[model samples]
Target chain A: MTTPNPTAAILIIGDEILSGRTRDANMYHLAGELTRIGIDLKESRVVSDDREAIVEAVRALSAKYTHVFTSGGIGPTHDDITADCIAAAFDRSIGVRDDAKALLTAHYEGRGVEFNDARMRMARIPEGAELIDNPVSIAPGFSVENVHVMAGVPNIFAAMVAGLLPRITGGKPLLSQSYRINRPESTVAEPLGDLAKRYPDLSMGSYPFNRDGAFGTNIVIRGQDGAMVEAALMELATLFPAEEHS
Target chain B: MTTPNPTAAILIIGDEILSGRTRDANMYHLAGELTRIGIDLKESRVVSDDREAIVEAVRALSAKYTHVFTSGGIGPTHDDITADCIAAAFDRSIGVRDDAKALLTAHYEGRGVEFNDARMRMARIPEGAELIDNPVSIAPGFSVENVHVMAGVPNIFAAMVAGLLPRITGGKPLLSQSYRINRPESTVAEPLGDLAKRYPDLSMGSYPFNRDGAFGTNIVIRGQDGAMVEAALMELATLFPAEEHS
Candidate 1:
């Protein structure tokens, strides 16, 4: 495992995601998983199923981040061209692999479904790619070079990622602490601002919410150093005189 | 309104959005809205509140698309720094405009709340910026040089976009239709594959969902042409053998 901070970026593909028809649960789940593994999620981009756009985004993200995890657009449908776009981006030939075919055949056999041509298309893998296991669905997501491509359906995506993430290296796991402040963001900005200056490493964010017609805030403190996060929490505690101090 | 096709992009900026704590509802809402108005949503990107990232995304998107609507990071808190980022990107100085100050001042005064420095920070606009009306909260989201920066909160974002969308020129509105197939995607792939060959302008997609412990498929047809989308739908209907049709 490399010693330096490992950064990962997620490229979420699909017109559904961009259109808001699907409330993306994968990003949050992946974020928590990446955080636990000490990976800094430097960036996440949502792009439609347009092949050229997908190819361009994949190239930009894959080149910049240590690891690139793309969710969605890997199905058998026409819009499911993420695998093809990824292959094009990496200059890899798109073809069916024996291993992926075997996995899909076994999965379909277990379900008592026919291993037809459309179903077989899921077995198409970028040349020289390693399969990422999908426990929920038999057709697996795949990883090539540094890019991991997975399903768009939340559960399948989560399962595919769960199988893949443990195998990769991560950075210093960030420690996170949050407390709800039953006051407007204005009420806490100054002290929170001061605390940020004091804990330069910690990323302190104040999210204002409207609860029961009364304004409240959730102050989130995040950093690689647990002690610094706790110290920031202590500083935040002094700022608002909050009832619940975590 | 000279329009061959109106094109728009959305820039969602928030650590919360990137973290997945906040499922981005605005992207969907805005995408649907733009589509309804005949504006093709060519691209959508989500970046964190990092000034450089925001500036970079804005500059790039603003250059590519006709209109760029951004949501998030326009609030009283320091992390709400989208305004500053936009100002920096456009090489314009940030200043509290008299109009924004008056609106905030009036809203706060009406509510009997103190319009302090933090609250006043909401009034800061980039030079040469035109304010997007926020009817929900007095704090307005602004548009500077083809970039419309709105609030990240769904309600405010929706409200601002509603007020702003009608003013812009939209191209031909998108036409869409869908039908469910009782059979698996495997059964219909060959025919759908052949159909896709005939309709080059239309985008066709099939989503497989597990219902009653069996796989069911929903085929969606989308395109700028209304008659073409309906024609494709009819072709799909004939191919699928729908309950009503047969």
Candidate 2:
């Protein structure tokens, strides 16, 4: 019996990203990590630091997917409204939790930094939520319902995902193999489609690349079964002949 | 009397992006262009090339926003199902249009390449849709109702945006200025909030960065009015004092 893959959606909350002030690092990092761990990253949304948008997105994503991972807006500023928004989405009360506060306090004291009111806001988490660790910074992320909220900074977000993903159950890891053909995508699309039809369970993707004035296509075959993936890759290698590109 | 700003949402369609095989470049480029043209980019979504998901997102975003821009899935592959999904979204008939076919024919003929069936698939356009130009490659993108579908490749997407944006009416360009302060966000949050309240029309965003073991914040002030943006920047500079950072 095959267990279906657990699906995830990512909600990126920050005005900087939507306004083009910052190129997102967290979404790309999380997508790779989730894919590796057998959790299918189905969709990702980027919304500005608006309260209503955040709450609405959190509610919708948490309901539709097995997990909803959010990055950004959990900071020490007025615009950092994600924690409150998450609580509002789930209709739960939120305030500074003692455990979270103690963690931040100890870290701040160790670093000789003042744990001011704004910094203290980091400890504010929804009721009945478990804290996700932030090894880079002491401020903890939290998982409320199906939603996991993490810091926007790339390093901190990566650290949080490392701590969080192991606890969640995932299905068999999706396996992928690629073959590079020096021919254009148009030349490869027809035969590739036939190959795809023969193996209905696997997904085939053709990504075209132009490197140093030479056009080529990277065709990736992906599926949950390793033996099936290997079989498909072998067929693709025979059809495309890898030595042409090498 | 102030007219409301036109709002837009971007739908990025591809499995490579969701699977972390490719980092997205189109969303960033589109966001910056939309911001410059005074269209408020309210939301952006990245979805894998699943038919139902694509159709649902296209319908929802088109209904809610002033304009919806979609990138990706107009290629010569089996997984390139965006055109069909778009037709299903609007309940329109789609087939290879003569204009699109002509363009691709000329491009391939000029390059001494075959204009085969797979390449001809790029010419398919939904009924009552207008073609968006693709100077990078000859395949045309299309605009149906408020939805504009463009190529996903960065260069082609950028070129299409250049060709398409000028044709649409835009509001006053959103003006912005940034001041980098060599202080933690905790140190700057209180006064920044006060300053934000003083200029309610402008938006204040505090982006924190940690570089080389030192922490700092970049405060960005944005609004439609140049005068309001300038005023906010002046206050921020005086409050933070760039000389301190220097």
Best by lDDT: 2
Candidate 1 deviant stretches above 4 angstroms: A1-4, A109-113, A243-246, B1-4, B243-246
- Over the stretch A140-226, how does candidate 1's per-residue lDDT look in tens digits? 898989999998777788888888977897678777899899887876787787778877777888887775567778889878788
Task: Give the backbone clash total of model 1.
Answer: 3
TM-score of chain B of each: 0.93, 0.96
**Residue A204, model 2: Cα distance from true site in angstroms:** 0.7
| Candidate 1 docking class | medium
lDDT of 2 at B14: 95
Count residue pairs with overlapping backbones in model 2.
0
Worst 10 residues of 2 chain A by lDDT: A207-216
RMSD each, Å:
3.0, 1.5
